[model samples]
Each structure stands twice: as structure tokens, then as C-alpha cells.
Target: MSMIKAHHLAVSYGHGEAALKVVKDVSFEVQKGETFGLVGESGCGKSTILGALAGRNKQWTGTLEIDGEEIGQKRTRSQLAKQQLVFQDPFGSIHPRHTIGRTLLEPLEIHGKDRRQERIEKVLTDVGLPLNFRYRYPHQLSGGQRQRVAIARALILEPKILLLDEPTSALDVSIQAEILNLLKDLREREQLTYILVSHDLAVVAHLCDRVAIMQSGGFVEVATRQQLLENTVEHPYTRILMDGSRGYVSERRKSDSAALPA
Candidate 1:
């Protein structure tokens, strides 16, 4: 089953003569329970597509279907709840004043879900957070803990699809792996589909079954994980990304080794 489908999708900012198109005529489908990744340099319309899909950016024209239902500029509450977005910066995304429990409760209250307390506790556990942390403010938690709370917030809605936008970019390298592994486990446990946007090829390769490489507001290539791992990707841009990602990993490893006590 196809969880998401888009054809000839174009997204723009502003109106009339001043309208700037950011995503141009791109098309793709993500299968149920599969992770689809979008990769490119900054400002390449990767997140623009995600915004369109999530109904945050309404200036888009295309055939878009989510979980078998067509989507439009305006979405009903249920339509809006079909998928949830997890942002890049956990600290920035969450409320500083709100307790973790309250932050999680807001959505459940809005959606009028039953057993709100039970749901909150379950989601906290699912994300591997202690129940007691619910009383803590966002500031009390570390970066990785804050991100797990963000994941818990998204999952509390019980949405089938997760739209992850640079989910680990703000965390330390060691913490990034922990969050990625949590996402992997959650996907299996929940049978969820994901659309992840990141500039890191290694991150994408680790989590995505297939990836779309974007440049200048359009898709340059869509390659499988096998193709990526085997060095069989055809696009020059894709190869460049692979090389850059390899260099980045090597540099990080060297830096880590140097930090170790001799």
C-alpha cells in the first residue's frame, strides 16, 4: 500500500508576480511502513515538499494523496492528524514553560482522545523516557532527552506517518545514533511510514529504504539504499554527496579517536 503519493507537485511562497516557487514538478510515492528520505544542500526545496504535505504550506499545486485520501489546501482535523511532523530543533520546537506531561496532553485534549493519562504515560515509555520526567520542564532535560520528548509528542497522536525534518541535526554525534535507533525501533513497533529530510547522506542511508536527491527545486535522482551502499548511484550529484558523506564520517571518527585518553 502506498502511504503517500505526489505528482507534479509545486510549492511557492507569496502571491502573484512576487511568488517564488521552491519545489517544482516533483513526484514520488512512499510505501506503507517504508522510510523515504529527501537529501540535498540547504534551500533545495526538500523541506518545502514536507511543508506542503503537512498542510503548513498551502501554496502548492499537485495530485497529493495520503493514506488513500486526497489532500487539499485545507484539511479537516482528522486529515490533519493523519500525519505529524517532528522538527529539527527540539528545544526550539517545544514550549519552555510547559511541563512534558502538559505538552503531551495538549494534543490529546484537542483531539478528545480517551484515557489521556494512560496515553501520555505510554508514549513517554515508548520513547524511553521515565514517567517522572513528565513533571520536568524542557530545560531540565539534555538535548537527546528533549528530542525523545519531541518524538513522544509526535507519536502521542498515534499517526501513521511521521514527517521528520532534520530530526537529529541539532544533537551531538553520539546522541544522533541513539535517536536514530529509537526511530528504527519505533517504526517497527508502530508499523509507521516516514518521510525524512536531511542533508546528511549517512543519516539517510541508515534509516531510509529509498532516497530522493534534490537540487534547484527538483529531484535530481531517486536511488535505493542498495544502490547507495554499493556505489552504483548514477547521478554525479549523488556521487558527490556520497563522497562528501564519507569524508564527514572519516573526519568525525578521527576527531573522536583523538579525544580518547591515551
Candidate 2:
């Protein structure tokens, strides 16, 4: 069974004539424990789709099912706890005044979960951060370290699915690999499903099992990772993306010494 299913999903901002539709009739399914990717340029509605799925955007229409239960309807706290979103900008996502420990504890407190200290420390360790680091504020950490904490904040709830909106895009290229490896390890260790949004084909290729290419708020093509690797995509937009990825790879080889994790 699909872990996530969206049928003819549409999302927009505002209402009536003032409304600006961002996602148009997009549909897809992601299997349990699989990493499905949405790849596109900025403003193509990739993050908008993720926001709708994560329940951050309520101005959406159509059927969205998570584990066979329809979303957009009122969900129980337990149902809401089954999914979590990890935002792109870690510094922006976390509160500046709050300590890392407080940030991790907030979710548990909201859910009324017990053993908050134990859960916080375990999540910090699971994300490869020292337990002592939790006592520090966001400003005390590096960009990569901040991103790790952001990820830990999401994982603290022990959600079965993660909506990743360009999770590594805000970090340095070198640090991106480390975080990607960390996510891969966490997903395997926790058996979590993911819907990863990224413009970087390399990042998607490195982490996703299947990919959907979005263009102008709609999906242009969907293909397996092997199909993407073999350059067998049928859509023109997908081909353009493939060409751009090749160019990026060529440029990176000359200038970037940091390789994506294997």
C-alpha cells in the first residue's frame, strides 16, 4: 500500500479572483519506506506541494491520503504525529532565542509525551550531535550543525514519514554530503518514508528511489532512478533538466572537490 497518495491535488493562495494557483492537479504515490523525489526549478510549486502534504497549507483541494486516511479532513493528534516536515532553512526554521534542548522538547511537550529528556538526548545522538550541544542556542552552532538540529527536531516526534523541502540546499556543498549521508542512515535505521523536494538532480539521484519532474506547477515526467541514470526520460522538460544536470556535473568536476556520498 502507498504510504502517501495525492489525487488531482491543487493548491493556491488567497480566495476567489485574487487567488494565485501554485500547484495544479498534481498526483503521485510514495510507497512505505521509499524516498520519492520532486525535482524542479524554483517557483515550480515543489515546496508548495510539500507544504500541502505536511498540513502547513490548508488552501488546497483534492484527495490527499496518508496511510489510507484522507488528509485535509480533521485529523486526530496521533494521525498528525505520523508525519513531519523538515524545512529548507534551518536557521529560519528554529527560534533564535530558544536553546536546542528547548527546540527538541517543544514537540514532545505539545504531544504530551513523557520522558522528554531521554527522547531529546536520543534524537540528538541519532542525528550525530553531542548531547551537550543541546544546551547551546542556535547562533552558537555552525550552518551544518544547525541543520542537524533542525532534522533532529523533526525526528524527535518519531514520525513515520518526512516531508523534506530542500533539506540540504542551504548548506555548503561539502556539508551537504554529510547531511545527506546522515538522512540516509536515519531513514534506514528508522524505516521512515520520505518525499524530498530539490532542484539539484544530483541530490535527488543520490537519495531518491524514484523522481517526478515538475514544470510550471505540474508534473512533466516521472521516472525511476535507473531511468534517470540511463538518460531515458521522454519529456522535453526532463531532457532539459538532464542536460542542465550534466552541465552542472561538468562544472563541479572542475571546481568542487567534495563528492556526493556513495
TM per candidate: 0.94, 0.93
Candidate 2, residue 135: lDDT: 95
Predicted candidate 2 versus true structure: per-residue lDDT over 59-156, tens digit per residue: 99999999888876566787778899998998899999999999999989989999999999999999999999989999999999999999999998
**Judged by lDDT, which candidate is best?**
1
Clash count list over all predictions: 0, 0
Error of 1 at 67 (Å): 0.5
Off by over 4 Å in 2: 248-262
Tens-digit per-residue lDDT, 73-148, candidate 1: 9999899889999999998988999999999999999999999999999999999999999999999999999999
Q: Can you tell me which runs of candidate 1 are displaced by over 4 Å? A: 248-262
